[model samples]
Target: MNQDIELLAAYWTIAGDIYPMGPTEVSPFSFENRMEAAGQAGFKGIGLVHNGMMDTVDKIGYPAMTAILEKNGIKHVELEFLVDWYLSGERRRQSDKVRQELLEAAEALGARSIKIGPGIGQEIADVKLMAKEFRLLCQQAAEVGTNVVLEIMPFSNVRNIETALAIVERADQPNGGLLLDIWHLERGGIKFSEISKIPARFIKSIELNDAHKYAIEPLWMDTIHKRVLPGDGTFDVPAFIKAVQAAGYEGPWGLEVLSDTHRKLPLEQMANRAYESTISQFRK
Candidate 1:
């Protein structure tokens, strides 16, 4: 394994349930099994979603869960998918509860960051208001000793590098930054040149995935079910890697292939392939 790369087994890589779309009916791998496979496959980190984290802790104690990850040699942890923070009323309150739990879990698991994003849609919110909310979220996360990273998605409000960077700048919290995913960058039409311009400190993390040059129909469905392995698609992954390295991002790099087909593989096979495919990019 390349010590500099710190490959992460992203949540969707092994998650049994795909949500909204239902279960993938893949390998019925348990959390411990996933961690063990990841470690054996040379992954240094593993991502945990909010529901997964809660369920894992409930089924096994937090200490026991931590022990399993430690025994598997997992170092970095990532928790994700907080939404509705920009809304007011009951929706925001519900989201806040989930966010609080996620932040607490991140602190407990020593996760690098909690990924947050706006709901998927074309509607854009007031950047200032978004910044204000982001600032408060960062402060809250800071209290738990975790970072809050805003993810830019093609269908989300923060749909481009510029908008994501702007919100992070306005928030101005050291613990608040951007979670740049290669898929989103490509689908959102963000140039690698723009990514190179971001200051290192503002890029909290980077996730790698590949897809066709032209988007599949119903982009959201395709994103959830059709992402290819890092080197198997049309993405200029080597260039993306070089750009981030040039920008001075030294954080963990995650393999976030969210494909239904991928979820059906045996645990070890999935982990090994994900790690191998991702590291091949850095080698180039």
Candidate 2:
């Protein structure tokens, strides 16, 4: 393993023109624009999320997008995905196909990992069930020469670093890993005191963002609502970064923010803000 820690610039959904689009105003910073911006910003890589995949891919074919990533010297892209289609039920084949699509996407984009937000339901947290299912996914990911990184989201069944590690432990595969997003860490009810307990080996990546005390009218009426920028909000992002550092996690860092207000401002400016906020927190 390289063991090098670098940051991957993400455009959650540079194309979503609707409700859950990213916080930063959608910029002309399309695939091409991101490539142009990467070197100047010192973004070691790109964390590509579906927060706009549905619309973005529809507008531009995956093959085309992948080509763009390659031309830009981007070595990998971490995809945001729903991983429920891979269970031992009616949708098993459907699930397999989805995983294959991810594999294909990796092949196209030359990505290293896919961020798997495993579906949660009554049986999702079942120890044995999640293990079996995750193991299968890991096997598939290995075959594709890619990694499966479980992302911890607010209201998630595996909503914290602890739960994420537990599930990965059960999976027991080298390709299995976890993603740490600060927004989810803050909202998922995890405190810094719990950091030492989280295993360092499984931390595949870390996400960055800050928030405020007063909540915005729920991003939607749902539990996984919206979020603000790194410095604009009230969350203690610097402390969170320090905790991750103490935990011995050395991996790619992602500057992620899900906001509409951000989008209205210049995308380049928002990206600069994210870059600045991340540096300030990492130093703290």
| Number of the top TM-score candidate | 1
lDDT of 2 by residue, 186-256 (tens): 76678875776767777777888766665555423232335566666778877887788888887777876
Per-candidate alpha-carbon RMSD to the true structure: 1.9, 4.1
lDDT of 1 by residue, 132-210 (tens): 9999999998988888889989888889777888888999999999988999889888998898778889999889999
Please give the lDDT score at residue 58 for candidate 2: 70
Indicate the residue-level lDDT of 105 in model 2. 70
For all candidates, what are the clash counts?
A: 0, 12
Off by over 4 Å in 2: 1-5, 13-29, 50-67, 86-94, 120-124, 216-225
Query: What are the Cα lDDT values of the candidates?
Result: 0.85, 0.65
Q: What does the lDDT read for residue 51 in candidate 2?
A: 35
Best by lDDT: 1
